[model samples]
Target: MRRVSEANGLRIWVDGDLRDEATRVDAVARFQTLLGILRAWRSEAGELRDEQRAGLGEGPVCDEAGNQFLSIGPVRTYTTFGGEIEWFAECTRRGVGMSQHLRNALWLNGRLNRTAADFYMIHEYAGVEFGGSLGIRDKLKLSTNSQGRLTRAANNLSPLEGGRHAKQSGEAGMTLDEQRTYVADLLRRWINLHSAA
Candidate 1:
């Protein structure tokens, strides 16, 4: 399939080898399905943006020291209503740049995908020590056991909690909501530490 056009918030893709009636019908059906899914996703995203705007006023969130950390605004699109937010505390640490992993983890957290958020934190952001001997996980004071639990949860160790494997007896781990809170707090602390550097 190839994209034919995108106009007025709608994208059109055309598939090759549609000379046959059955193939043409199938292609049209598939296109309709894709359009439906896009519409639903867009609607959900818009609702989330509305909720965020209502909860957080139309202004940048500032830290206690009056440093801006996050700012939310509309996405400039010609035909769709969307939102985007920039989140980053001013990094004052010498030779320490703001990591994209941290930014992506924070963004995924806002999307309510705790599993992906935790994966980014554990696999990407936590592995690198920002100019210190301790990695981000260590800086966050996450115990070895806690780190293992988070890794297990993010890597699909328990089927009961969105994991791939069947749930074992007494395989307790932090719930997705709990992980969300924990990761968010850690990211906040990280931002604060960098802000004060």
Candidate 2:
């Protein structure tokens, strides 16, 4: 628990986890008192700004296009007392449907960056179920070989020659150019969804 004296002569009390009954009741009473004080104070709505409401160090984010894109902060990973990994965030927003889209994008990016298992899973699903296109099943198979090994050899040797290798390997059913076009379309759609007004 923590308490501080505000410049306006208001006592600010921040209580930690209130386990005991007494602490809980006292915290509730303190919150009620604070609420009453705030309600009693009258202020002009115009005096408040969006940045102020968003608190300190919060504002518009920039994307690759250098546009002011609204984004939820990156997801935070923490280890709990029980030795389990978890994520936590307290998100507040002003724009319509902002939180939903921002959160979805942030969560997806975080999962991809941290684990990448979801990425492989989704890629497999795309190859098997949707044929790698948005909704076109082009008969792309993503399962392992008969020996339960990845069909495509892990060719991290030459990124410049990746397309040729993929074509020669015959693992990726679509040509490199076709794959690039498909990915470009997908990225365009994703950017549109995230940057929609």
Which candidate has the top score in TM-score? 1
TM-score of each: 0.41, 0.20
Clashing pairs in 1: none
- In candidate 2, which residue pairs clash? none
Cα lDDT of candidate 2 equals 0.31
- lDDT of model 2, residue 131: 38
**Against the unseen true structure, what C-alpha lDDT does each candidate score?**
0.46, 0.31
What is the C-alpha lDDT profile of model 2 across 92-180, one tens digit per residue? 11211353432232233222111222222323433443334423222222232311122132222123434223234334444333332
Quote model 2's TM-score: 0.20
The per-residue C-alpha lDDT of model 1 at residue 132 equals 26
**Model 2 per-residue lDDT at 151:** 18
Q: For residues 1-197, what per-residue lDDT tens digits would candidate 1 score against the true structure?
A: 23235542334455567687877876655544333222222322322344445434444577899887666565533342333111221231211255555444444444432343334353346456453224654565656666666655665546545454464444446666556445555555655565556
Model 2 misplaced stretches (Cα beyond 4 Å): 1-102, 112-116, 121-133, 136-188, 194-197
Which residue runs does candidate 1 get wrong by more than 4 Å? 1-97, 116-123, 129-134, 156-160, 164-170
